[model samples]
Target: MSDSLLQLSAIDIATGSNPLYTVLWMHGLGADGNDFVPVVQTLDLPATPIRFLFPHAPLQPVTINGGHTMRAWYDIQHTDFIKQEDKAGLYRSQRAIVALIEHENQRGIPSSHIILAGFSQGAAMALHVGLRHPDKLAGIMVLSGYLPLVHEIRQEAHVANQLTPIFMAHGSYDPVVPVKLARSSLQLLRDYHYSVDWHEYPMAHAVCDQELIDISRWLKNILKEALISDHQNR
Candidate 1:
């Protein structure tokens, strides 16, 4: 609802050209839109032009960080994340993210051609918003993040994306977001019959090369249609 949409950096096709698809990515706590810019380059994507939008979270005081102000999707009230949730902040960011999705719709990219992705706190946001999004999406990618609002996701999650593919990856040795948290989230999605392509790497909270390879492969599978369409036009 605010000007959060303006706080984004996009890697787009050439001027005056419209991309057939878009990937709206979000950054983790304390990071800005530039955090994942380099990751895009490493992805072995389809030939079809794809736009990537990295939106920055609004600067706010994070309680877990001793009230230090930083760019975070929501305020962490406690170390035990799900015990006491930030419902207000979560919904606030959700509206902002929904606005971003609508902005893409106005630019001629339908929800079906867009992928929602994020890492850490950003990943949590992506999962929260993407599930409740009214329209079907290409897919949801979660990197080192867990599902929030689990108690209400069943009631809140839209039916449109129930069948949407989900790609989730996490590190086994992750201290920040414990691997068990990610696993439980995966189990919850499976319990609800959501199609999830899950992966685990032997690393820390950071991403590994193998994980990137897996992510690239998953993206190719999701966007293969665009690749085929682009080839026909060429």
Candidate 2:
């Protein structure tokens, strides 16, 4: 639980632009924070100066292998309803999320200017942590990701003021996590009274062009609203 500074690192594009917002993005299993750098660039972020926090997951043993050290926000164990637990992985990454948010606060960015995002396993962590965030965030983006605890989330999720706007996208042909699973996840959130904007692209388990486009649009809306809210609060 002590500070290790190992959660996520950042890539600063558009250095000339005043960093107006912070986005904490996590990578999929076995990958580091750098995995999503391409997507960041593809967003065509302007010099408006946005800080991208690409947190590296803790190195731990994966179930796919004999306990080896690799980047993973948590372990997947087995898909059984009772055994689909992340245990230490989730708690450790949660602490890292806390550290990252605190660091952003020190940088003069408020919680309203922060966005939490991730893909695959990282995406699950994003939802788990972002939903439980005591303060409202600029937004929460989940790509090819599902809820870590569907039942527990509905029971415990909270936001400060505005409803937590979520963007959920999946690939129709995704075999790694399966597109149907993503759809089911979206439906479940909706059934639970969560606000979610859902999308599906004809691709595999990885990100696609349509997904990126939607994400960009989603962020633009959230950023615009965040700026307005900031000014109004002032």
What's the TM-score of each model vs. the native?
A: 0.91, 0.89
Candidate 1 residues lying further than 4 Å off, grouped into runs, are 1-16, 225-234
lDDT of 1 at 87: 87
lDDT of each: 0.87, 0.78
Consecutive 10-residue window with the lowest summed lDDT within model 2? 7-16
Worst 10 residues of 1 by lDDT: 7-16
lDDT of 2 by residue, 130-185 (tens): 88888888888999888876767765677462377888988888877777767777
Candidate 1: lDDT over CA atoms?
Answer: 0.87
Q: Cα RMSD (Å) between model 2 and the true structure?
A: 2.4
**Model 1 deviation from the true structure expressed as Cα RMSD, one decimal place:** 3.2
Best by lDDT: 1
How far is 13's C-alpha from truth in model 1 (Å)?
6.9
Across residues 33-85, which tens digit of lDDT does each residue of candidate 1 receive? 88888888798776777888888788888999999999888899887788789
Clashes of 2: 5
Q: Which portions of model 2 miss their true places by more than 4 Å?
A: 1-17, 79-82
